[model samples]
Target: MPSAISRFAKFAAIAALTSATVFASLDDAEARRAGSSGFGSRGTRTFQAPPVTSTAPAPAAPIERSMTPRPQTTAPATAQQPFGAQRPGLFGGFGRSMIGGLIAGGLLGMLLGHGFGGGFGFLGMLLQIALIGGAVMLAMRYFANRRQPSYGAGGQGGSFSRSNSMSPANNSSFQIPAIGSGAGSRASSRGNRPSDEIGLAQADLDQFEELLTDVQTAYGAEDYATLRRLTTPEAMSYLAEELGENATNGVRNRVSDVKLLQGDIAEAWREDGQEYATLAMRYSSIDAMVERDSGRVVSGDDRRPSESIEVWTFVRKSGADWKLAAIQGSEQRAA
Candidate 1:
């Protein structure tokens, strides 16, 4: 036995080395466990703690959890696709919507025809507005663009009547008035005073009959040139345009059943050393259409005899020679 102090020192040194060796061994074992089975422990043989280790909290339990496969959330998304893309009904589309609205309104009107007082029908209201408004607009536009027609006495083919020209005789049977003959004096007084009244009343009446005969003859013969001579320039132009249109459209109008109803001089006056007289004549005729190619009468407005009244004015350059100046006629269409 050495000194007591020396002996105590040697014992302490040996105890210290033993504790360090135990610590080193525990670290090696923990590393091995962490690398392999992840959780391993060693028993303590003495009063020393098992090991010194970092106190890092154990990795949080994996956030992933067991799934119950809830009522197919993804399946619901697929089921909604077809319904979202489905097309609309016909009446719901833009182009056909107006037609649907009209039909619906009409049907509603029919159902409520008796319910509403005074026969207020939906379709009737719409139709009335359309027709009336359209007619008014058309009439306004036409009147705005048109001027009144003017008439006067002018020479035929820019020349005076010739003495040798053959025409209906004066004082002849053809010269007789169609209406009450000599009574023309009593029918239309030339002057307000009884004295200056000219016996031209008979002459005026005769002039009317002649004018009508002239028109009928010219129309029958399709003598457009002679018709131009008898009618005003405006009237002539209108007829020519009508004929041109008919030709372009390939149509021919036929006439028949010609009858003279009445003829009388409406007025008579003297202008520039010439006698000017206006005649009123009434007549009836049947108009028929003929095919340009077949000569067959196809269609016409005068299936039933149509009546017309013509107002004609004539001028005479000399005593026995007379020619038409202005002529106007109105033909009412048969219903």
Candidate 2:
């Protein structure tokens, strides 16, 4: 058999090599991630998928990553906490009295040298007490979790009246001087269309178009400041992570000729004083990745522009300009 010390050294070596390999794999994965992958916060609708639009006939991809905290669902309210909430205080009432009696009996046996606590002494008594207390706590916790209600298909926030949400008071419209606004282009009947509580105007749509160009160019140029200004903090963080990965891979993304072909509102809603709009857009651009130092194209055609269809969710609070909050790729090709 190999000596114990030699075996330990070999094990350590193997562990170190494995750790290095894992880290290298992670770095490569990050590099390939490029940018957001159907990720980012969309307020209460973070987990919900946006509706498909004419520009993007297919459904939007599910959000794979997000900063939005998952909403905590609770059981229906009753007289107490929830479904028969009778949480006893981990060995409370008569249980406490029984524990006290046991401790007293154990101490008495120890005084008589009758092998109290398995003949281990006071330390053993302490261990016994700890073990019992831990068990009681665990049992209480398990019951509590069992009683906790699981989220339904849509949760509380998911089910809302489309007619009520898209009422005249909440109707948002815009007029695009260039290609005509897509207002009233929505499906005649609202099935799962997200509703906006607050209405947005023509100027907001115009600005959204402007932001589309600005954000794309800024990301291509790796301009962190511009990106920060145009996107929400959470969205900016994801963009920065992508940029860092590109830098690590010694390459950079370049984009130009950003022209919006068509776009339509997928959903618009307001919550907690913030306005949100998810828009499906089709645009063309010359997007390429190139070596950082030499600026030689590595992935995309520099001259030939390609089309992309994506859903972008924008958010704004009070009187602030709309900022990009999320990005999702379309799921299916347009028929």
Per-residue lDDT of candidate 2, residues 143-209 (tens digit):
5445333211111111110001110121222323222223333532545543444555677777878
lDDT tens digits by residue: candidate 1, 1-335: 33564454344334433433343343234323221111111111111111110110111111011121213235563465543232332222452345434434433443444311125444354454345335434543344234211112111121111011112222222223332344333433433111111235555455556556565556544569987876545445544554565556566555555555554444455545666554444455555555668766555443565544444445665565456554432221111
Q: Against the hidden reference, what TM-scores do the models get?
A: 0.37, 0.58
TM-score of candidate 2 relative to the true fold: 0.58
lDDT of 1 at 198: 25
lDDT of each: 0.38, 0.61
Runs of candidate 1 exceeding 4 Å displacement: 1-198, 201-207, 225-241, 289-291, 294-304, 330-335
**Shift of residue 117 alpha carbon in model 2, Å:** 45
